[model samples]
Target: MSAAGSGPEDLARGVLEGGARSIGRAISEVERDSVTVPAILRRVFPRTGRARIIGITGPPGAGKSTLVQRLAQAYRRAGRRVGIVAVDPSSPFTGGAILGDRIRMSEIYTDPGVFIRSMATRGALGGLARATSDAVDVLDAAGFDPILIETVGVGQDEVDIVRAADTIAVVLVPGLGDDIQAIKAGILEIADVFVVNKAEREGADRAVAELSMMLDLAGHPEWRPPIVKTSAPSGSGVPEAVAALEAHGAHLAASGEGRRRRSLRARSRLLALLETRFRRAIEARAPEPDGLEQAVAAVAERREDPYSAAARLFEELVPPPREAAERRSG
Candidate 1:
């Protein structure tokens, strides 16, 4: 399909037909927040909500990429089509990804059953790219099952980004800095499955034990997260990890958390879209370039407060109901 004249309907049809080029274009629109995004997403929304979104996150050296590779292979072996979204850090100068995970996934890079896309975070914090969800939606609409999202590995505090996933696996390794204490507070709650990768390395058993203790201390969870040990390099324990993820998926579906999770994700996306729209509207209402500069200078010098300035701008975009009625009548 030609990007120039292709409307949302054409693009939606192309995506549902599982054409890689069409899906790539769809995700590009999502990342760039193009004018056609709303229409494209609206048309494709019904085709989503079927793929299992599983997130793998951890520190830089925890081997997340390798583990994701093995997991994708395992899924493909079972005759399931896999899609991977690897969120990588963007270069400061060019705003492109450095060390994209696709480089590391050379083995499966050519697999027809696997679709892999590396997304530059573009300064979005908390591990995930801002448009990662939209990209996942495109993959879902393309009929890929079990989409895997590998985060930028921002460690503990950034784990919240994985809340978008139906099942989150937090990868850990032995010999990392205070591994248990550092992650217990922030990652423990959101993690659905714990993976101790590089299991043959020193202190692997100890790491597993510490994670177990922390889970115990976190109190009784209705569905306790299972810890699976993996040596991704040798491809050991990968099946167990995959099984654990599947089991968690089943638990979520049976207990109705699946619906709740989707609802929460949708709510977040809606709020983000609203915030973006409002910001654009406010920018469009700016008086003049010089006037806008003066307004910023005033705020910086404390001559005007930010809240008042924001309220004033909002009033211009959306007048009060009574004021609007009076203007209409007059």
Candidate 2:
């Protein structure tokens, strides 16, 4: 499809037909937050929810890209179309991804049944791009099953993957100095399955033992996260990791956690959309010289406090409820 004349409906139709070009274009629009996004999403929303989203996240050097490639291969062997969304670190100058994951995953680049998209974090926190979830929705609408989301090797606080994936597999390596303590607070609790990649190393078993002990101490009565040892390069224990992920998927479905998670995801998406729209509205109302610009100047000059300026801007942008009702009625 030509990019020039393609309307949202045309793009949405192409996406639903599983055309790779259409999928790519749709995702680009999402990343750019284009004006056509709402129309395209409205058209394609019905076709989503069929894909089982899996999130893979851990610290740097955990070999997440290779492991994602392995998991994609395994799912392909099962005769499923796989979509991989690899969130890569943004380049400081260009604001584009370093694209290292694409290079590392070049082995599967030619696979006909696999679709891969690498997104830049673009200063968004939580180890994901702001547009990552929308891109997953596009892939889902395009008929890809079992989508795998590999987060930028994240720190303790970047656990937003929990709200985006049905199953989360936290990857860890043996020698990552105090693996348990590194992720104990934020990342550990989000794991449905823990993968100890590079298990051929000397301390692999010890890492597994420590993770197990942590799980025991956490005392998850509903479902304790399973630890899987994997060597991504050698392809050992990957199938077991896949199996553990599937088991957690099953548990989520059987125990009704899946529904709860979907609800939470829906809420998060709605709130994010609302925030974006409100910001846009505020920006539209606050033009240069006499609006937000003047307010900022006042605050910077110490003539007005930030809180007071913000309140004034909000009031100007959004009138009181009674005044809004009167305006509407008038």
Candidate 3:
């Protein structure tokens, strides 16, 4: 389809046709503008509720990709359509498998019921791939039963998929000194499930204990998100891990938590889109050259207070909250 005729509905139709190339092109546009993603999402919204969105994240060398591959296999074995987003290091995005080797997931790739895509944080993209979330929706709309998002075990900043996913599995391994400390805030605080992958490793037990204790202290209301230990390579503990994940999914679906969780995700996504749009509008209207550098220089020279300078910029961009009411009344 030409650019002029390609609207979100067209993309949605393309996605439903199982045309991976069309889906990839659709995601590129969504990534460029967060708002554009929501437009496609709106068209595919109802169709999306059918898939189970699973996010896997952890620190480097934690075996997240391998575990995701295994998990995809397990789901496919049970006669389900599975979609996977393999997120890898930025370097691999330039050449090698940032998303890991297609070979790792090669088993399920030819299953006819499984679909996979690779995404990475590259170049000026410091965060997760902007298309990651959009691609998930596309897969969801395409009738994939479970969409597995496997992100490289980076720190908090890269774990943004936790926000976009329906259920999150924070994968970890033993022998890492500050594993818990590294994942404390944005990532750990939001985990719906935890996987201690490479469970055969020496300190794997210790790592599981530490994480379990933290989860107990936090006190989730209906269910304590289970911690599953797994040796993804050897296939040990894979069954229990799969069972626990499945049970957690059922619980969410039955207890109305799924609806609540999705509502929260949608709200977060909408606000993020709004902020991105507002920033772009402000930047386009009042372009600031070397804006951050100018602010730093002003502070270093004591010509302006940093806090006041930030406030000045806010005033330049955002009108008083009542501007909306005025627009409505006008």
lDDT-best of 1 and 2: 2
TM-score of each: 0.86, 0.88, 0.79
All candidates' lDDT scores? 0.78, 0.81, 0.72
Candidate order, TM-score descending:
2, 1, 3
Misplaced by over 4 Å in model 2 are 1-5, 90-107, 123-128, 287-290, 323-330
lDDT of 1 at 208: 83
**Per-residue lDDT of candidate 3, residues 1-330 (tens digit):** 642246776776777776665566666665565445667777776777788888888776677767777887888888888888766654232244434455555667677677776664554333344467677878888778788887765555466665567788888787665757865865787677888888888988888888888878888878887888899877777888878778888888899988898897778666766776776665565437636557668889999998987777677667787996898799
Cα lDDT tens digits for candidate 1, 134-196: 888889999999999887445542564566689999898987647556666666667889899
| Model 3 lDDT-worst window of ten | 90-99
- Supply candidate 1's per-residue lDDT for 77: 92
Cα lDDT over the full model 3:
0.72
Q: Is candidate 2 or candidate 3 better by TM-score?
A: 2
Predicted structure 2: lDDT: 0.81
